[model samples]
Target chain A: MNVKDKYYQEVLRFWKDLTPNQRELVDHSIIKKHFNKGEAMRSSSDQCSGLFLIESGQVRAYIISENGKEITLYRLFDRDVCIFSASCIMKNISFDIFIETEKETTAYLIPTSIFDKLSKESMAVQVFANELMASRFSDVMWIMEQTLFMTLDKRLAIFLLEQSNIEESDTIKITHEKIANHLGSAREVITRMLKYFQEEGIISLSRGTIHIVNRKRLEQLTLY
Target chain B: MNVKDKYYQEVLRFWKDLTPNQRELVDHSIIKKHFNKGEAMRSSSDQCSGLFLIESGQVRAYIISENGKEITLYRLFDRDVCIFSASCIMKNISFDIFIETEKETTAYLIPTSIFDKLSKESMAVQVFANELMASRFSDVMWIMEQTLFMTLDKRLAIFLLEQSNIEESDTIKITHEKIANHLGSAREVITRMLKYFQEEGIISLSRGTIHIVNRKRLEQLTLY
Candidate 1:
């Protein structure tokens, strides 16, 4: 399906009770756009005036600390919007995110003005917001649960498994620096873990890639 | 103001945009109640059918792992809600949370049926959901930041500072066990650090209370 068809479905599922005219309005306002790997759709200090629904590839939303440390708030894949920043938009704060494409990525952005109109006039829009919030809460709770219940090694293994699930390759394409940023760890620590896991035959590493060798064992003990 | 009044004001801001009739509906439906320390609002496998918004005191929501470890997800103090169990309310899953009053706590419960209605019909309720999600995201971001940017001792220190903030006291009315649970660390480690901080004249301990002796220095450092 084309990108518009994807958002067409998202808007349908999002506002299930939307009147035909409202749904059509949403679809009409949404515009599909693409960005390359090195390009940004939204900068850290940009205005948050649109709803982004990803259709293809991936996007990374991260912040840099005052001391130049990077902290990744989200890694948006297909279907996950840059929704968390909507509060900043509502509060009139500068967007605290860097939404950069990890690859050639397509998304649909519906303007905030349109959303404001619908939210004021439409119950379906309210329900849509509720579902979006529910999903976001679920994502945050999972992160909290992982931090509380899983060890660093387990977290690494889970991340690797997730990467494998996303790509159809035993060898996933991502850098240690990127993984370090996402896990909020030093690159040195990630390299050490890669060596350790490789020695244990749990994984194999090549230049800029990691191949999962023991998926079952990785999942079994990764989050135990 | 009384605790109920404090909570009513908090909810008032969240429901500010609702029509008076809609606001009154929530007013009539929500019931404020109080619980003593150690009282359980819902235990493991119990039916969860409402959302509890904390007005006074503290609430600890934890789940028991397969290895019999109590994993604390989120701690709810005044102005917060135990939103981690919301899906259980929505999907009617037997509750995974064991929510207990950490002090003589007062809270209000909005029935799930009412919540579903408000979610569908009210912008005020939608804002509440968004704010809750934003707060949860902030919580996870804090944990992730601690995991990467701070040492174990630093994390414990920040936790203590946060606890002190919540209690609005120079002396923290909590034990090392509580600190360990909240920090996801060992009690032995917390004890060792507490002793060291005391020896360094950074803090003083008596019975179960931890007094901040070097508030200025503690603020400069990551430790509480």
Candidate 2:
């Protein structure tokens, strides 16, 4: 299939109730592009321009504080559509959120004007957009709950387990600084926690990587 | 004006784009009711049944933790619409968010079935729904950022300033425990912070209220 046909199929699969007009608009307006790992797609100062649909690879959506500390709001993977990342489309959302590629990524970008038009013309598009927005809101809410109620140790443990699962391996290749940035904590704090975990025989930490030695203990740590 | 006309004016003001059919559906399906202070509107196990449009007074939307701790997600005031509080209309959203009255509140409830039908039939309804969802998502995102990146002292100061503005009084008639609950922190933590603020002469604490003494200092605290 051609690029347009490829994106058309993806959009159709994702939102099955799209009317013919919406499908036509989406098929014509989408622009496909590729970004290398670590490339920034959206930044704090830029206006939100459109919806991004990831066909392959991963994207990290995050926010940075005035002091330059960063927190991961959520990650968009294959088949995920991110509308909030581009804030210009919706006037009520004004906060600056940055979206960057986690790896070499290929994605289809649908301009906000076209998406807004489709949303205004198609109920299916509107429903799909609402669901997506609600889903992101729920993710942020979960993060807030974790930050408020759960201790750093529990969060770190859960993060490690989630990373392991996402990577599909017990040995995860990540650094302390990267983990701290993702968790919105200082590097020293994460290093100290990892050291404590190491002393407890829960995980074996090496330079730039961590191996889960006692999965049971690590899992137990996340339970509470 | 009659009760139906009273609700009609409110709905028209909130969703100005509603088509005649959509308006008719809303008018026919809406149920106007009054809720006393501290009454629950939606609970953890209940499915969302419809859209709630606040006419007067205030409503608090929050989540309760497994251990009985509570966190205020957002608040609904006069002219505000809350769709996420009722989860049944949207299938992907499953989080347990409880909506309760902070004061005696009068609201117009449109059943989910009617709202869904209107949404499917009217592009105007769809756009309005999308905007509302996007707005709520933005609120949740702000909360996540505050919880993850902001220090408790900064958060408390910001919260107090916001409350002062909301209530239009420097001497706010709210207890430390209530403030703690709103910020999703322990009462002891808030008390300690409030005592420190008192020592710093930024605020004065009494039996059941906190009086802002130096608003400038409290505002400065939130800058960092």
Give the alpha carbon lDDT tens digit for every residue of A1-224 in model 1: 66655556664455556676887788789877888886777775655657777888888766655556775555788877766435444432222556678878988787777776776677556556556655644554565466456667988888898788878678898899878776766799988988898898888899988988987777876745
lDDT for residue B204 in candidate 1, whole number 0-100: 94
Name the lDDT of candidate 2: 0.81
In model 2, the number of clashes is 3
Interface RMSD of 2: 1.7
**Model 2, residue A22: what's the lDDT?**
71
Off by over 4 Å in 1: A1-7, A10-28, A47-49, A62-74, A90-98, A214-224, B1-32, B53-55, B61-98, B121-123, B152-154, B165-168, B222-224
Give the TM-scores of the predictions, in the order they appear. 0.81, 0.91
Task: Report the poorest 10 consecutive residues by lDDT, candidate 1 chain A.
Answer: A86-95
